[model samples]
Target: MIDIRLGGARPESAQGCVAVPVPAADGGAPVAITPGLLPDDVAAEAAAYLAETEHKGAAGSVQSLPRPLRQPSKLLLVGVGAGDEAGWRTAGAALARAAVREAELTVLAPAELTDAALRGLAEGLWLASYRFAMIEPKADAAPKLAQVTVAVAATPEREAALAAARTVSDLTRFARDLTNTPSQLKTPAWFVEQVLARTGARVTATVRDQDQLAAEGFGGILAVGGGSAQPPRLLQLSWAPEGATRHVVLVGKGITFDTGGIDIKPTEAMQLMRKDMGAAATVCATILAAAELDLPVRVTVLAPLAENMVSGSSWRSGDVVTHYGGLTSEVHSTDAEGRVVLADAMAYAVARLEPDLLLDLATLTGASRVALGKKTAAVFSDNEELVAGIGTAAAQAGELVWRLPLADEYVKDVAAEIADLNNAAGNPGAITAALYLREFAGPLRDRWLHVDMSAPSWSGGTDGELVKGATGWGVRTLVRWLQGLAA
Candidate 1:
């Protein structure tokens, strides 16, 4: 984690690389670039460099000065396109990348730094500075920037914003670390242990092994995890503060590694299956962040941990199993196993927890990625208010989520002749998978929201704050949404 601190004004005098924001090409108001923000000689030199290089201020664009007339070792002209929150975040990330070799860095906050903007800048810096060196060989070279200072006005609101930013950044990185770990090292038991270790007094975590799962009738989880030598487990993390007004139950599909069981995936497709538990990592991170922030809401997380692998005892296609609420489902494809485990967890949440609002996330389908691309998660819900609220939260957090119609008419696609539903449907697979989970939502279907996060959970390449691996996509959105409920 990067040590980020609030610094005094005049970032040019700060150590290491000093990042200064430049407005976009079509920027409306003229942001005063005076000596007060940057030294007069340095500002003139930057303007000359920009003119020489034809540097139009577009978001995520950078221009570095190796020999600058300033106290700082180097100067960075970071582009703030349109001066929006997203643009500010992009600028912050760009600055981080440019200053990757620097041991210390400072970002000069713009004159119009609102609480939201400050949070965005801080998030970008911390997120971009993330490095996952768990298994990789250590480099003899000096590490990346160990400390970052954001030069902003010292106010109570700004301090609160910075605190929130730190919470999200740290938890998101935590999720990324869990998701990127090798599947062999991160099994069902390991996930439970990690959760228990991170949770505080406000949160109580309980784990139920295979024996308990069978007794509780979680057939879906049991069947999918039957092939793995390590037994399946159901982890329930609850945070119910006294006098809490609303109950929000979250279910995450925790497939530590997916090999498609009896119906195996191709060799090329099986490479990144370790990240199949991205949803579990995300929800756990959100709950931990909520506990840290002390949000006044009753939150419960149901994570069904399993590994979908192939063996003599592997669950085969056409096998029928009864889920938690007695809903029987036929296994059409083992690759569609995420929704299977989630079904049991969701049904259990509805039957036992009786939440005011229920949301489940899973890397459930490849068709979702094919349909929504890799940057946006597909959302499905019958409740308009819930959809709108999540949309607002996503916008505030700069996460992309697109709401697809529930299309109840297509429920028959997953309907089976011998069972209540089949795990896999033909075309429009994402919607059908969501519909399959909807059946387990019971009478409170309108209160349930299912997010198909297969697409956004991992990034193929570096983009702004998102790195090239597990993106930790949903944590910030969930945190912001839960915070809104508390508000």
Candidate 2:
């Protein structure tokens, strides 16, 4: 993790050269650090790098100035593409990673930093700062980032900009911690307990255990998780809006760990199974954000959590399972457990909570990764307005979200031979999973959006702003979307 601080030297106090290093796009040049250049060096070198190299502020390019001359020793000037906020943020992340080798570093922002740019920079740093060292005994050898100096040219606005960046950093860290937890320690029960312990008067968390679920007819959760030793749970968290009529429902698939049940997953595929609860973590984090921001809109989050394990009691193929909303589903494949849990949670949220808009997220399908890849999150929904809102939110949050079609024609694959629907669809796995969830959502169909976050839920590579574990993909998107609605 990087420690951030304000620069001690104001523009008037500058006495030494600051290295304005340019990160070569193709690794063509060893990082060039111009010593003793100061702020003027940063400006001059940035222009020269941009004009000479025409760096598009592309993912690999340098984005910001690392103040090497300052007491911190190294100032990195990273080139964010074309002066855009996202570009600068991407650059900020690149610089953070490059500076990991340094004992500590400070980043100097341009004199006039917009709120958007500041926010992006903070988020990028947080994203890039995450390190998953739990499995590696030597992981602790990696030096911690001691400080980041968001040095804006000394002015009244400096304080505000720095303050804003700090706020964003705090929120980004909050989201990151939720996403980084391992499944073994972050089960549904544990998550609920944590929420109960964390939430104050403004938020409420309710967890329904196996016995309560059985009595309440939430069969979808029971049938899907029945095979595992860990019992199923439904965590409902809510906050009342102040003088607001609009309400939003957020649902997450909280499979604490997915072992593919009777249809076991391969060893490689099961390695990151702990991140299967990413959806749940995201929803929980978003709810906390909403409460923290005091959004004037009623919000309800439903996280249906369970461990998908193989056992004698596991639901088998061809078995008809009844859900909470009185819908019968045929269990064709036990591995398609995410949608099963989400189906019950979505229904409960829409019917019981009665939110005006619904959005649900899950690492539910491999097909989503195939469609959207690792950087972009796949979004499916019938409502264009909601989709637009989501798109805007993702843009603001500096996250990637691509809208995918939820074609009505594809809904047939979920139709079962003997039941109302099939838990596992025959084609378009990701889309079909969302389609399966739609059945239990009832009449609020147009207000719904489903995010298939299969790719971004966990990382195989430690790229810029992405750690090698759970990414906490949906937290920022959900928080931004809800905040936008509130505004």
Candidate 3:
């Protein structure tokens, strides 16, 4: 993790590269800088550079100049086009990427940056600076922006906001590590131990093995895990703080590796299947974040772990699996195993926990990816208010989520001829998948929100706060939403 702190020495006295925020001038006026932030000589030097380069102070733009002072080697003018939170965030990310070779950075914030904008700046820097190189690389190959210090007048509110931003970034990165782990080391049993290690003492951890799940009738998990040498597991982690009035139960699909069972996916498609467990990583990190932040809300997480592989024992497409609580689902496509396992977890959550909100996230459908593209996720539910609230939370958390209609008319499409429901219903797949999960929600349907994060969970390339692998998409949004309940 990068070392970050708030309210260090003044910009002129900073130890490493000094970065100064420069707002774009109105109507092409002269360059403007905070009156007291920089010394007269260095400010004059920066003004000269901006004029020479014709810099307009566009958001996420940087211009470097030699510092007149002998101590600091360089001067950076980071742009905040509109000086808004979004602009600050972009500026922060851009600065981080630009300062990769520097050992330390001292960022001079805007004179009037609000708590919200400050949080955005800190979050952008931390998230963008994250690197997940698995191999042992040469010493010179590593980028070295190890320490960051923000130079500003510190207040309790500002310091608290910084700490909060750090917490979210650190936890989100933790989730990213889990999601990016190779399936060889990330089996169902390994995942459970990882959860137990991080789940603080305030939280309780329960592990149900294949035998327990079989006795308890968790057919969906067993059916999915039947093909792999690794058995299935159901992990329930809970953080129930005192005086908590709201309870939120989150369910996630934990397919550690998906060869798509007997019905295999294409070579290219199966390559990234290790990320099939993204939702489980996200929800686990989220509930643990709630414990770390010590929010006044009760949170429970249910993760159904499995690996859908190919073997003679693999569950076939025509098979009907009897799930927990005696509900039956026809496996129309073994590739649709995410929602199958998710159904068992959601049924367990709905039956055992009385939740103010019931939410489940999964990388369940490629159709969802087709509809929403790679950066945005598709959310489904009958609760309009809950969907709106989730959108708001995603916006605040710097994650992307869009609500897709439940389409009650499509409810009939999820029905199977022989069983109660079909795992893979026909076209408009994302909608029918949500509808299928709703069948298992059973009377808690009204409060349930299902997120199909098929595309957003894995990033194809780095963009701003996103890295190239497992994106840890939902942890930020879910954490912020749960924390808001405390208010």
Candidate 4:
């Protein structure tokens, strides 16, 4: 994990590389220096370098000056285009990549660093510093920057803002780590253990194994996991503080590994199936962060973990399984098993938890990726107010979420001849999948929101705050939403 701290010290006095922001001017090169906290000589040299090189200070651009730059080991001139929050985030990420080899770094906060800008900067640095070295071995080279100090004027509000930023960065990295781990090592049982270990004394966690799930009539989970040697698990994590006013239940689709069951996917499609559990990771990280922050709200998370493999016992197409709420689903395509497990969890959350608001996240359909591209997650809900709230929260957190309508006409696509729903809906698959999960939401259908995160769960390459893989897309949005409820 990357160590981040908030300090009142000026950037020029700090050791290691110091990132200085250069705000873009009207048309010519950048002329404004943020913070203006650098030493006189260092500041003059940076201005001269920019003028001599004609560095425009475009967003995401970096200009580096090696040693002999006054006091610091190096000077990094980062571009903050238009001096907006988004530009600051891009500048922070660019600084992180430029200072990859440095062991310690400091970023001078803009003189007017709003709470939003502070959050963006913190998120960028911590997110860009993430690297998964679990399975692959790394070279025995010099260590990357382990500590990052955001130099700002110390005050209660700034300190609180810094704390919030650190919390988001840490938990987002936690979710990323879970999503990046190899499926072989991160089984259903392993996921449960991780939840317990990371959330000790913060949240109450309980796990229901195969026998328990079967006894409880969780047909969706059982049928999906029956194909694999490792049985399924329904893990519940709860955080209920005294005087909590509202209850929110989050359901995550936790397919540890998907081989597409009897209907195996092509080799190219199955290669990244280890990240099928990205939704589970997001929910777990969100609830744990809420508990750590001691938010005054009751929160519960239901994660259905399974491994969809090809075997004699694998549930095949045309089979009908009765979900927890007595809604039967016809398995039209074995590859569409995420909605099946999620159905069971959603049903359980609605029937038992009776939450005021219910939200389920899943990487359930590739159609979502096709429709919304790779950066945005598709959100479906019948309630306009809930959707608006989600949109607001997502915007505030800098997470991209587009509200896809839940048209009643789309429900016909998932209608089964012999069952209440079908796993595979023909066209507009993402919308139909949400309709399928809506069946389990039952009486509280209007209170439910489904997030189809097929695309944003994993990144093809580095982008802004996203690292190479496991983007951890939904954690910040969920956290912000929950925080608003508490507020």
TM-score of each model, in listed order:
0.96, 0.87, 0.96, 0.95
Model 2, residue 120: C-alpha shift (Å): 1.1
Model 3 segments more than 4 A misplaced: 24-31, 68-71
Candidate 1, residues 349-392, lDDT tens digits: the string is 88899899999999888888888898999999999999998999
The clash count for each model shown is 0, 23, 0, 0
TM-score of 3: 0.96
Shift in Å, residue 341, candidate 1: 0.7
lDDT score, residue 170, model 3? Answer: 85
Expressed as tens digits, the lDDT of each residue in 1-487 for candidate 3 is 6677777887567655888887777887866777777777877777888888887888778998765557466878888777877777777888888898888989877557788888888888888887776797678978789888878778899988888888888888988888899999999999999889887689899999999999999999999999989999999999999999989999988999999888899999899999999999999999888988899999999999999999888999999999988899988999999989999998888887878889999998888888989889999888888898889889888788988888989988899999999999978999999899999889989999999998999888868778689888998899888877788
lDDT of 4 by residue, 1-487 (tens): 5677777466546676788888788866357675366877878888888887777878778889876744777888888777676787788788778888787888887667777777777777877777787555455553487888878766688777768878888999989988899988889999889878898786999899999998899999999999999989999999999999899999999999999999899999999999999999999999998988889989999999999998999999999998887889988999999999999998888888979999999998999889999989999998888888888888877788998878889878888899988899878888888888888889889899999998999999988878888988799999989988888
> Which window of 10 residues has the lowest lDDT sum in candidate 4?
134-143
Per-residue lDDT of candidate 2, residues 173-239 (tens digit): 5545655677678676776776677667889878899999999888889987898777889988998
**Ranking of models by TM-score:** 3, 1, 4, 2
lDDT, model 4, position 445: 96
TM-score quality measure for candidate 2: 0.87
Worst 10 residues of 3 by lDDT: 66-75
Ranking of predictions according to lDDT: 3, 1, 4, 2
Q: Stretches of candidate 1 above 4 Å error?
A: 9-15, 27-35, 68-70, 136-142
Q: Record all residue pairs in model 3 with backbone atoms less than 3 Å apart, i.e. clashing.
A: none
Candidate 2: how many backbone clashes?
23
